[model samples]
Target: MAVLTVNDLCKTFGAGTARSNRVLDHISFDVRGQTFVSVVGPSGCGKSTLLNIISGVETHTSGDVSVTSDEGRPARLGYVFQDPRLLPWRTVRKNMLYVQDKDDDQARRRVSTYLDMVGLGQHGDFFPGQLSGGMQQRVGIARAFAVEPDLLIMDEPFSHLDAITARGLRAQLQDIWAQSRKTVVFVTHDVVEAVELSDRIIVLQPGGRIFEDIPIDLPRPRRQSDPAVATLQAEVLARLEKMKAITPQAATAV
Candidate 1:
């Protein structure tokens, strides 16, 4: 069964007014468990708005989003934002544990496991300020996974890292996804990053609607230089450029 469904979603700000803005337009998509889906678009394309709506952080002006298999169960929703957003004073372990109220030994064990999984077990005692940008982001990932979330939402989580670090983390994230099989929705502006990490790529245009949905159909541990990845990235990039060309100059003309 599909884990999440977004049906004919629409969101507008300042409706029926001179200053109104239509952010999302009839967006629809579905996500299954253990699948990595990336949404890519221009800077002001409402990508983050769509993700916020899905996470229940923001409400859509119209249409509906529904999640199956998550009605009464405690679902872990991991969010890796553009910034690590770690607590400055708290040690990595403490910052991670802050989100979990459960005291069961099982819970503690899971926390430790995710810490090690993200390569932060040895640095759990260190403060966020002491770690490198990439390492702090790793801590953020560990904190998110500590809850064992049913869904993971990443909004350009590695945009701040250097290219080498971003590439390495991409591989590590793929490993984590393979091991945990959590439902993942990764939002990125980088086409290569989206191709490397996702099982499917959903391109969002100026509006929140999906412009293209393409399955990767490539083997795991995909390399950036792989012919298939390069070709597919080129294709997606072309689509993005075309989208920009077609978008109207203003809402008045639409």
Candidate 2:
């Protein structure tokens, strides 16, 4: 049931050179099917670098990275970046349909379904320019879900949004994920958000090595307002702070 696996992963910039920088070193992890995993780390912990390597946007120096489909077919992927990255000229529906394998009734239905799930059913005809930042991000989320990727990669999708907007989107994301149950790998520096959204969290330390792999045992459909949820969030944040104190080289942002 392993959808994605990274074995002894290593990535270096200008390897073997005098000024070479080793970003990721001997990283390893496995993302099982239909589970939500979050990677949280300091500024230079190679969080995004690991994600890029998984998405094939960047190459790893040495490692095994594999994504497999259940039916023995090619594994498909979906990505939601910090920015919406929608075409300015394309309408909402058109933007969602852009990454689809083809234009067909099933695909059209999927687009409509996810748009409605993100509460943007009525804005299909609207251009990206017409929507607010939060709305555009919702469209991006919907587009990724519409594709129904085997593995979904999210890179701080709410990092650019205002606090209130980010909170609302986080809730929406939880609801959609509850129903779809897509395997997700989310990268963020926000410990509270990571605790709320992830079933298991992988903490990357200063050198791209895993500091901790914690499991979240809370109930689903979690909300920040919930007392139990808030308590766990506080605990996770405190642990990260302790990690920061121990490793003074790591940047603290929780």
Candidate 3:
């Protein structure tokens, strides 16, 4: 299992003087095992920064953050960004292999398995450019899971796709997550998407503080058409609206 802990975490883009901009402020939370957590907020609200800090792509100004695997080792991480981020010259299979610790047969098989999970089994030999935008994102998702990471970080992975494509990919992701059960921290502005995918939703207000940490008690394989899922999504969206109404800073920050 994977364990993640954050205590009084803070991040500032500039440390001193008049130009200093603090993005995250004393954020604290913990996630354990295979939970899927979504961080939702408006743009520039430090959603991506939080993920970057957790993934070590960015540094925090102060506070404690720890991620560990059940085996008492540093947890392996997987990340899927807004774009595919694939090398143009590489085949899908090669791109998947690029991040693997090993190129052995077992590792290769694992890569293939994940590709299949994302419905890209036969496209492994194709270059990223050969695929459509949605297909490329599918490859990105497949590549992330191929690594068998203890923690997976996704930053608006489906944001760039068309609505129909995004919906399809979301369903695919839910199916894959149900089977793989990887610990995931997904960042999104879409409350409906958050409700569908997360075991818990963490709402980040402007100025980088958490407004609410709401648990999603809904069942797996959630669909927008499902009444329970829709109800929860509406409730979350309503809360976000109310938050914006009450927090004058949140309105200005957006």
Candidate 4:
């Protein structure tokens, strides 16, 4: 099992200056093993910055943040960004192999397993340019899971694709997560996507404060077409709308 904790987190750019900007202000949350948590908010609400802080790509101005495996070891992390971010010169399989800590037979097998999971098994020999945009993103997802991270972080991994392609990839992602049961923290602006894919949804208001924390009690393998899923998504969206109404700054930011 893996655990992630964020306490009293604060991030400010150009702190203590006339032009300073504070993106996150005293945000905190905890996520346990096998839980799928989504952080959804409007633009400039620090969604991506929060992910960056958790992934160590950026530092927080003040707070305590930690990720640890069950045995008290540092948790292993994998990330899937908005874009594929693949190396154009490398083959798909070689790109998968790039981030792996080992080059042994077992590592190769793991890479192959994840590739097949994303329906990219037969295309591993191809280069990035040889695959469609969606296929390349699939390769990125496979590479993230191939490392078998204790905590997986995705920053709107499907937001760059066409609606049809995004829908397909979302389904594929749900299937893979159901099987692997990896602890995931996903960032997205889409309420429908959050309702369908998350165990809990955290809504961040402007200035990086939490407006609401919602639990999605629905079952797994949910579809956007399902009546129950649609109902929940609508309810969540309405709640977000209410948040915007209450916060004048948030409404302007959105």
Q: Between the candidate structures 1 and 3, which one is better when assessed by TM-score? A: 3
Query: Over the stretch 82-193, how does candidate 2's per-residue lDDT look in tens digits?
Result: 9999999999999999999999999999999999999999999999999999999999999999999999999999999999999999999999999999999999998889
Off by over 4 Å in 4: 252-254
RMSD of each: 3.0, 1.0, 1.3, 1.1
The TM-score of candidate 3 is: 0.97
Global lDDT scores for all candidate models: 0.83, 0.93, 0.91, 0.92
In order of appearance, the predictions have TM-scores of 0.92, 0.98, 0.97, 0.97
For model 2, the run of ten residues with the poorest summed lDDT? 245-254
Q: How many clashing residue pairs appear in each of the predictions shown?
A: 1, 0, 0, 0
Candidate 1 vs candidate 2: the TM-score winner is 2
Evaluate model 3: give its lDDT: 0.91
- Judging by TM-score, tell me the better candidate of 2 and 3: 2
Model 1, position 252: C-alpha lDDT score = 24
Q: Indicate which candidate wins on lDDT.
A: 2
Which regions of candidate 2 are displaced past 4 Å?
Answer: 251-254
